[model samples]
Target: MDTITTLIERNDDFVENRFPSGLKLVPTLKTLIIGCVDPRVDAAHILGVQLGDAAIIRNVGGRVTPAAIEELVMLRKVTQAGGGDMGAGWDLIVLHHTQCGITRLGAEPALLATYFGVDQQELAGKAINDPHEAVTVDVAALKASSSLAGGFLVSGMVYDVETGRTEVVVAPSLLREETTVG
Candidate 1:
């Protein structure tokens, strides 16, 4: 049959034979991964993340845009609604990959500006053309978000499409850490 039909058949088999039952609304690992929308860089497949392991958010460039931050806020509210807190020791990961379509959009300044909701002049600060740099930029953005609260571990990773390997661009740390400069 067609691709959709085949997928539907697979789903039927999944629901009937192999679906895990009684998974909680909260992820088992209490982790959320923000990654590029590229199918080849799917965190679930590449990272061997099984069902309910971690929640995944995919978008262009996997940048920490305002919309993505809002999603995190909403997710926290959602977990609260489900009688679970999304704060404290939860893990947040930003994933970017090589050969992303967003790289191509960098050549189109107007489009890139529109996508980032920033002026074309400010696009250089976004590091749109580099996955490693974008990951660093995105993770820092998350760490700096006041709306996200604190006590969450956040990291950045870059996936290499050619070698199917991932490198940690930023080591995990508290999303909001208190620093006292002496």
Candidate 2:
């Protein structure tokens, strides 16, 4: 009858209809894509990327953590030994969508810190008090710690769901702007 009820009913039907393919996912995905866990944002499908091409690491707001760092290192090793490189030939896309629920945490420092398992008041004292900045900074840190080759590049961007626009926040050389004035 209401919006919430309607949404719940629709989701129930959707899952029930799709249960035949329940978690029957492919293993050994190559690329490592750090993306938000937003239902509206399907990193693989939205990017026109295929399965077995990437290992999607999703979390609240798509924030990169120590685990993400470790995953990248492991992936880098595997790719290298197999005569591949995670940084160069492969892809690493950080999909942070605009109007994200994570941004709400930004305005609430204490709650954000609590959610992230960090000292609330203490972290707020740092220059990076904003939750968005906190997440993006950590993502960048993980990218730097990766053992991917010289060609490997790391970037950050926010996807606009309404307009289907993606804006680069932290641009690695790989996704640099190539301006060709017509």
The candidate maximizing lDDT is 1
The parts of candidate 1 lying over 4 Å away from their true place are 177-182
**Candidate 1 C-alpha lDDT tens digits along 19-80:** 99998888989999998888898999999998988889899888899889888888887887
Q: Which stretches in model 2 have alpha-carbon errors above 4 Å?
A: 1-30, 77-85, 106-111, 114-118, 121-139, 143-151, 174-182
| Pairs in clash, predicted candidate 2 | 87-152, 88-152
Global lDDT scores for all candidate models: 0.86, 0.61
lDDT of prediction 2 = 0.61
What's model 2's lDDT at 28?
41
Candidate 2: tens digits of C-alpha lDDT, residues 1-182: 99999999998997787444533123244356788788987787777665455678887777665555666667666655766545544456676776677755557887666655568766553224243454467555554543434444566677778987676777654522222211
